[model samples]
Target chain A: MITQKINKDNITTSGDTAHYTEGLQEEQYLTDLERQAIDHEVALVPYKSAAVIEALKIVQHHRRWISDDSLNAIAAYLQMSPAEVDSVATFYNLIFRKPVGRHVILVCDSISCYVMKYGDIYKALQEKLHIKFGETTSDQCYTLLPNCCLGCCDHAPAMMIDNDLYKDVTVDMLDRILQKYS
Target chain B: MERPLTQYIHPGCPPFDIREYEMTGGYSALQKVLKSMTPQEVQKLVQDSGLKGRGGAGFNTGMKWSFVPMGDSAPHPKYLIANADEMEPGTFKDRLLLEGNPHQLIEGMILAAYAIQADVSYIFLRWAYKKAAQLLRKSIHEAYAAGLLGKNILGSGFSLEMHLHTGVGRYMCGEETALLNALEGKRATPRAKPPFPQISGLYGKPTIVNNVETLCNLPHIVNNGAEWFKSLGNGSADSGTKLYGVSGKVNNPGCWELPMGVTVRELIEEHAGGMKNGYQLKGFLPGGASTDFLTAEHLDVKMDFASVTAAGSRLGTGTMVVMDDATCPVGFVHNLQHFFAQESCGWCTPCREGLPWVEKLLLSLEQGSGTTEDVELLQMHTQWLGPGNTFCALAPGAMEPLQSALKYFREDFEKHVALRRCPYQ
Candidate 1:
C-alpha cells in the first residue's frame, strides 16, 4: 500500500523515482513485525542509524541470514545506506551475511577450549556433519563455525546450537546434541 | 572466608526471584542508600571500600563513578551501563553472578545509578550468553513491576530505567568505549579517551560503564561500611572478595568467591583441586587469555592487582588458564593469538595489521617453519604493539601471552624449530 501510494505520485522525477523505489524496496523486504521491532530499537537510541546493528539482528532473527534485500530494507528503515549498514554488519563475527543451516553450530576455538582438546571435538563434528568450518551440511541440518570462548571455560570445549550452550562437549556426545537440534 | 559476592548465588538451581532476593538481604542496600545516604556519600563509601573493576582493568570503581559530572549541571539522562559482554576466554565469573541472582545485579545497578544519578541503565551483554540474557530480561521486568525501576525508584524521588542490550557477538565490545559505540548502534570499535565516558558517553551524556561484578559489589559496599568491605580482603591492600576461577586440565575446574589476595597455589591446589593426575602445572595465564603467563615459580604470588602486577602480570579477570606439561606452549599461545587477530576492530593500523602478522609468526613456529629471525620478529612485534602504540589496549593485550611465553617458554619455541615438528605432537 505504501509503495503503491509512492509510485502513483504525479510528479515523477528521477529523484522522486529513486525515493519511491527505495520505499517499494523497503516494503518488499520488511513485514509489519520486523518494522515494529526496528522501531523499538530506534526508540532506545538517539538517532535511527544508531539502531542499525540491532535492526540487522532483528531482521536476521526473522529471516535466518541477512540477504542483500534484507540488508537494504534494514538500511532504509534505520536511515542508513546499504554500504553503511554492511560496514557495521561485516565487523561482527556473529552476523550471518550468508545463509546458515537449520541449526548453526558455534564451536569454541579459544584458548581454554583448545587446551581441553577442542580439535578432537571439531574433528568429530566434521566427520559427523561432513562439513568444514563455515560450510552447511547438504541436508541443511547444521552450519559449522568456529567461535571464540562461549564463556564457560570451567566447562571447556563448549559449543552453542542456536541459543543453547553445550558445555564439556565430547566427541561421543556430538550425535545426541546434534540430533536434538534436527 | 567471606564470600560476600557468591553467598546467595546458588548454582544448579534457578536464580532467586525478587522475593527470594529480598528475603536474602538483596535490595536492602538500595533501600539503605535511598533512605539515608546521598549519592555522594554512596560514591564516597564505595571509593573508600577499595573495590576495583573485576573486568581485566582493576580501576577503582567508586573513583570511576566519581568522575561523572554531578549536580544539576551534569548531562541529563546520564547513563549507567553494566559491561556484561563477557567474551574474555577463561573469564566466566560474570556469567555466574549474572545467571545466579540477577536481582542482585539489578539491585546493584539501581544503587550505582542512584550514586551517579544516571537516568538510564543498560546491560550490554554479549550474544552467546543467551541464558543470562533470558534471566536478566525477566528480572528487569520484575524490577520495573516492583517500583525499583522505570520511575521514582523506590519512591526516593530518583528515577532509573534499566534495559538489556545484547551484542551481535563482538569481542571488541568488551572495551568500555567500544561498548558505548556498540550501544549507540555503530560497529563495536573503541573510542579515543580524553573526555572519558564519565563526562561524555552514551549519546554524548555522562555515562558510567561498570563491569557486571563491579556493579554487583555496589549494594554490598553501601549496606556494609567501607571498613567492613575493606576487611573482607585477605591481607592484600585491595578490598572485597573476588570470584576466582580455574580452567584447563585442573582436577576440578570451577570458579569460587575467595578473598582478593588468595595465592595462586590456593586457587590451583585447594580451590581447583590441583590439576589432573599426570599433568604438572607448567605455566598459567594468571587471568584470562589477555594476561601475561605466570609460571609455576609464581605460585605464591597473591592474586591482588598490585601483587600480581608486581609478579609481572595483571590479575586479569582472576581466572587462570592453567597450562600443563602435556600441552605445548607454542600451540597454546598460538590459539590465543589467532583469536586476538580475528577480533581486532580494524579501526587502528597496528592492531588490525600487527595482530595477524604475530599470529602468522606463531603459526609458523608451531608448524616448525619458524627461524631465529622469526622469533626475533615476534619479540619486535611485542615491543611495537606495547602500550601507547595502538589506538586501544587490544594489540598490547594480544602481545601479553606471546611476550611472557617467549620469556618463560623460550626453549619450547626453540624445540619446535630444532626438531622440525611440533614436539608435543
Candidate 2:
C-alpha cells in the first residue's frame, strides 16, 4: 500500500470558519482507506491545489466520479481550499464531474474514420443507447462520447466499449455489440 | 533484390495473421529474450543496438531504460508506457503496426517491461486509433491466455500486465508528460518538465515512455543481436529499420519499412512511385508536419537522424508528406497551420493564441489581403513560440513546417503577398 503523511496542527474544529466547516464535512466523505491515506500524507505535502487535483484523480479512479464530499476531502487532504479543487476539476474534460454509466462507448470521427462513415456508427450508437453524446442512459448502462480517432485507419469506423475496442463497425455490428452490453 | 527489412509485407497478400506471423518466426524474439537473456542483459543489448526513440525526440532507448532506478529501496512501482498516440500529421506508422502485427508490439512490450522491472504497462493510444486499440486489446488477451503476459510469463518467474488506455483525440497528448497526465485521468495538457516522465510518471511512479516503433524493435534487437541489426542500415551508428509513412502528392502514398540511410530520391522514386500525374515535385515535409521541409535540391540527402539534421531538419517519425508544383505553397502551409491551430489543446498562452494568429496571417496572405509585413510577423511568431517557450514539444513541433515553409518558399509567399491572391488559386 502507498504511504501518506498527515499533520495534526492544521486540523481545526471551529464550525464558523470556512476551512473548519469544509474540513468537518470532508472528513465524512472519505472511505476508510482514503481517510487513512489522507491522514498519512496531509502533514508532509502542504496540500496545494495541484495535490488536490492529484488526490481527485485517485478518488475518481476508485469511485469513478468525484462527489462533493470527496472533493472537499481532497481539498482538506491537500491542505487546500475545497473551492480550489472544484474549480480545477470542472475545468478539465477528463474529470467526471457527474456520475457516468458503467460502460463508455467512444466512437472515432477523425479524418480517416470520417471518410469511412463513422457518423453512421455514432448515429447507430445514439439510437441503440437512447442517449446523446456525453449523456448517460436513464438506466446508467452506457455513456456515449465522440472521439477524434482510434488510429486504426485500415479498420476505419471503430468504437470502444470500455477498454475493449470494436473495429470496422457498421450499423449491423452496432446492434449486436450493444445487445451484448445491454 | 537485397533482403527487404519488411519482408513480412507482401505486395498483394492479405494482412498477415497471428498464425502467419508465428510461422515467420514472429514470437521467436520474445522467446529468445525470455529464455536466454536476463532483463539487465536485454537492456545492455538494446543500449548496444543504438536504437534511438522513434517518437520525434530521438533519445537513445537503451540509455532511457537505465534511468529507472531498480531494487526495493527505489520506487515501489514502475510503469512502461507505449506511446501509441500517433497524432502527428502524416505519421500513420504505429497504426499499421498495431493493426497488422500487434503480437510484435506485445512481444516488444513484454521485453521492455522486464527490462524496466515494471509490473504494469499501458499502451496510451490516440483517441483516433479505435481499430488499432481493438486489435491491441485482443492481442493482449491472447498473450495473457498464453501466459506470455500476466503472472509468471513462460514460467520465467517474470510477470507483466498490459492495458490499453485510449486518448480523447488531442495532438498535445503525444507529448510524454501530457500523455502521462491523460493516462492518470486529467485534461490532456503538457506538464512542466524538470521531473521528466522517466523519473516520475503514471500515478507518480518511475515510468519509461517509448514510441510504438521503438518498442517494436526490442524483440528483434534481443533476438538477432545488436551487431546484425546495425549492419542492416548504412551508417555504423544508425541501426535497424524505420517504418516510413509517405503522403500527399506522391504516386503511391503509404507506409514502407526500409533500412535507415536510404536516400529521399530512392524513397520517392522507388518506394513512393514518384509524383502522380507527371506532376513535378516541389518540396516535402520530410518527417510529418513537425520537421522542416526538404526541396528537390535535397533529394539526394540520406533519410537518417544525423543526415536529416545536418541538412537542417529532424528526422521526426520518418513521415514524408510530399508536395507537388501545382499545389500553391501558401495554401498548403495555410491548411497545415489550420490543423495545428485546431489541435492546439489551448493549454498554454502562446500555442492557444499564437497558432491561430499565424493561421490568420497565412490565410490573409494566401487570399492576397496582406503586405510583406504579415510574412515577417509569421516568421517572428514561429521563432518566438518554438522550443524554449512551450511547456512541451507540441508547440515547438507546430512551428517546424511554418519555419521551413517560410524559408524554402519565401518567393511563393512573397508572390501571394504582392498579388493579394495565389496564381494557382
TM-score of each: 0.96, 0.74
Q: Report RMSD (Å) for each prediction in the order shown.
A: 3.2, 8.1
lDDT per residue as tens, model 1, B71-112: 987879899999999999888999999999899889889989
Q: lDDT, candidate 2, residue B91? A: 67
Q: C-alpha displacement of B324 in model 1, angstroms?
A: 0.6
Q: Which candidate gets the maximum TM-score versus the true structure?
A: 1
The native-contact fractions of the candidates, in order shown, are 0.96, 0.05
> Which CAPRI quality tier does the interface of model 1 achieve?
high
What TM-score would chain B of candidate 1 score versus the native chain B? 0.99
Q: Candidate 2's error at B14, in angstroms?
A: 6.7
Task: Say which candidate scores most in lDDT.
Answer: 1
Candidate 2 regions exceeding 4 Å error are A1-182, B1-6, B9-21
Model 2 interface root-mean-square deviation: 5.5
* Model 1 alpha-carbon drift over 4 Å, by segment: A1-22
